[model samples]
Target chain A: MSAEVELQNVSIAFGNFYAAKNVNVKIGAGEFFSFLGPSGCGKTTLLRAVSGFLEPSQGKVLIDGQDMSGIGPNKRPTSLIFQNLALFPLMSVADNIAFSLEVRGHDKVQRRKRADELLDLVALNGQGDKKVHELSGGQKQRVAIARALAVEPKVLLLDEPLSALDLKLRQKMRTELRAIQQRVGITFIYITHDQGEALTMSDRVGVMNDGELEQVGSCYDVYEAPCTPFVATFVGENNAFYGKVEKVEGVKVKVQTGGSSFIGQAGLGLDKKNYKFKAGDEVIMFVRPEAISLKGNSKKTQNSFSAEVKTIEFEGNLKNIFLRSAEDVDIRFSVPSSSDTSGMEPSKNVSLSFSQDNAVVLPTGALALD
Target chain B: MNSFYKKNGPVIATFFLVAIIFWLVFLIVIPQLYMLDLSFRPNLPPLLRGGPDDVYTLTHYKHFLYGSETSKDAYNYVDIGVFLDTIITAVLVTIINLCFCYPIAFYIAKLATPNTARLLVLALVIPFWINELLRSFAIRILFAGEGVINNILLELGLISTAVNFIALDIALYTGLTYAYILLMIFPLYNALETLDTNQLEAAKDLGSSTVRTHWRIVIPHAKAGIASGSTMVFMLTAGALATPVVLSSPNTYWFTQLIYQWFNMNDNWSRGSAYSIILLVVSVTFVLLMMRLFKVTIGEVVR
Candidate 1:
């Protein structure tokens, strides 16, 4: 049977400071879940807690519905691939891959056969006898994975395994890792800070901020529909505007900006229950750079603004056009390089518009704008 | 390349080389050569006792190697028994020190916490800096017949007659060992400290228990340290003479005590030089044998 992991209001505090705070997550069997955050945001701490390196101070950790309390790392059915890969440098590749079996007192021939199968699985066939130091960085990465899987662990935990690799190699390994997980049909809990890696490989991504989990959902939901300002800012690029709510409908709210009022979508089923748009209540509106398009005609729409193009920057596939409204409010709009807007002159006033669905209204709280 | 070398020049490097070689000859090589030459000279003959032109002979070396109690030359000053005693004492002291020092060194290096480790290293260095003679005198208090230890034991009713605390060969071994334990431990601790702790953890996580992990991982990593520390202790102990003279009676004289007897007490410089050469050869041979057995480079073991 496959394994499911659950962390029940877990909190890990170091002396007077909390490294992870009340983290609760339920990962289903055979799911490729990822904990995504910037460095020191406790993603690795959470992964370590799952792997039984550090116990939570206030809650229970359950694996496959069994309490993992007081269990040591070696006693757990989880195998972790450390950030440095932690390969046995003195041992040959095959011996390293066969270590778990060898320790369990299996026959040498049996351990060798299993090690060979795992080597072939990781696509390092016929190179098992070579020492770990004799291999390239990418090959060492594969060896680490092979060693972790040789134990036939129900859950595999990887802590930033690709952080040491160059960018091209990292990208290539991401696909290989996902394929290996699918082939094995085991639960893979990955930890990483690079948003691209989290988005590209994880079946579900959990965003962590300040030691607390902000949101957990599919890659698209977490990226396209961020629940808070931190999620919006961290997941992707966005242009923020501070304004006050002017009116409210069933699922739509109208916010008033400098010299302009526009309709936007209301927060939908988000965690903050107090997020109701009463008239004159201050809030912030988030619009992605690509969502807002530059228009030549100055026509009024449900959500539209008139601004001047301050500067234009070419970024290979896209152009970043900085804009400022007549009231001196700054805005940025991104357009595809192939757009005919390349002929537009700088410092000229242009109209910008986007559908209300593309606008996300963030409630005024700790993350509220000035 | 020739132009580059000419610009930076080889004169400075050549000058440094010649200077080092000259210093070595004056300080080390020349003295060693003189010692070798002295080992070959015969003992002073009675006919030239009042003159400087003594005839050279192999009488001293011959007596040292082949003389027996009944042989006429056995009455000569060279006593093979003395050299044999020094070699045996040196070997016994080396073995004893190794047996006691290795475990403590391993614990300090591999097991103690950081604060405890610092304190242990500090504790080891304290006695090391105290004058060796003062340290040996301190050992007298511990082994004194009616000193503090005997007094405490009497109060505890553990023995009678003070137990002759410094009795027999025990005193010599105790004094020499107390003085040399740190020498054996410090090198071993340094070597064990360089070992990567990750190897041990990896071994344990792979399923080997604590004891098995030590045998497979910790022991192998500490092999260089053990070999080096043992060799140093062996060499130093083999050549030690002061402890036997100060702490033991003539019946328990060590090999170096015998070497001293030949050189000074009996005025036999030729035989003493021969004994010194033998000690040097034996120390070098043992070091080489250990290096070969451990399959480690000599540099790794020593450092």
Candidate 2:
């Protein structure tokens, strides 16, 4: 029902300034791909370029192998749901959904029938005669989706459609949006600055910074094995410890910090010679909060450190214990509230350990190493 | 109560009341009441204060609506031609200005680049800084028979004889309406600019072409502006005096030219006051009818 999209080394420029740099991405058919980044990071620009509002300054934007150059937005087999939803306030719900059909010169009866079908598709059956403004926010959101789907566009583009809703409603819409996308079986290209929205719904996400794509991967790779410091800080909360590479043996590298030595796995494609990490070569260790486990009355892993608990953050199901080592290397360890858990008391010394596989040694320059 | 009065409260309220009373007597109520009285009296006798005998007569209105039999010429008689001309000219001017101004307004509102839009708006405003009469005179000079236009035409071999450009009714209408083109554009620009561009994009993304988008999203949203601009252009062109006097030949006259003829040429203030009242009623009626037809509030149209 939907066609795939491909952007091959595409770049967009405004006079001398590049709004989107050489970006290459392939969205396969029926994939819920998301372009995720903060505002002004060129994700929306890239989406607009794909939608034919903006023409790429370099390379090609192809829809299923057909070049989209010189094509206007209306000519494209793509539909975009604006951030404001952009529903026609003057029309009834049915007319708003059947707008594209009317443009295509379909008769009144046929357009109405198609509108009714789309209303049912979005679960607003029998409500097609209601005025657009009469609908609630959620209903308007569904109408926008139904209107976009009425044209049966090969690719549906959604630009921060849920950014205007409250947190709880946004979450509810998230599942509903994903479900609707799945039911329609269209290639949905969603754009959002919210990392949670991307991770929860996307088949894959392309993280953008400035005007360039920083990394493209599945949610797991983007969150865990982030190739750049920007991605590590952006994808989720991460605690970083500065260190020096003391040794590299096989797949593991031992990095020495201020008051102790910690071991972590070296990244895959980083050139070792480029880093030239001899003994005492500066490096940075990136660790996730959940990866650090408290070793209470249990045998520790290959890497363990003694740290005094500085603060306890009670997050309902899980408690995040903030620990400080002798060198004052503050670290966080997430412990779930279980029956066997030894309740962590603040200011108590505890041993927290994580396997080298869980920690990654990122060569210096991308991040500051103390 | 005396203490409160001494605390500047009574003084402030008294001053405000006095100001309102003064405005009512001098600015609004007095002139209108005077005009109403004048509309019922004979021209010469009322000007001479012929006492109670001159008060309360339907003679001026009847004479303006149905001409006097003793008059040798109908043009000399107070006839309904002026009223009809004023309405027809105002309607035509409104239509003409709307056609010329809407596209420019849309470009400034929706499609123009930032700097270019600003420059275009600035260009529109530039001609207004000079006196409007001077501008009209400048147009006259360029088109006059012995002026620059005829000379250029002669040089270019386009015409062998000088053309009398100002000896036409169209010149007066064109000049007067063009003077108020900017006024029509401002309200339209404001309305069109407030429309959501994303709505247009959504329409386009839904397979509507540029024309369809303009009709559905752009025009409907610009209703308030259109209504407002129509009111302004009608009121202005209907009540205009200077353009016709300067540009029109004596054979063909605008309605305001006739009203002035009553007040100044014939010194018939009673007939002029009746014409003024008729003009006011017609303008108000047309505006009300338009508002009702368009389903827009007067406040929305004005603001």
DockQ, all models: 0.41, 0.78
Distance (Å) between predicted and true CA of A261, model 2?
1.3
Q: Model 2: runs farther than 4 Å from truth?
A: A269-281, A297-300, A306-311, A321-325, A328-330, A337-350, A365-370, B1-25, B44-50, B71-78, B149-163
DockQ of candidate 2 compared with the true complex: 0.78
Count steric clashes of candidate 1.
Answer: 2
Worst ten-residue run, lDDT, model 1 chain B? Answer: B74-83
Clashing pairs in 2: none
lDDT of 2: 0.84
- lDDT per residue for candidate 1 within B67-148, as digits (tens), equals 6447766343445566666666777787788778878888998889889988988987887787776776777767778788
Per residue, candidate 1 scores C-alpha lDDT tens digits across A74-99 of: 78888888888878766789988998
Residue B199's lDDT within candidate 2 is: 89
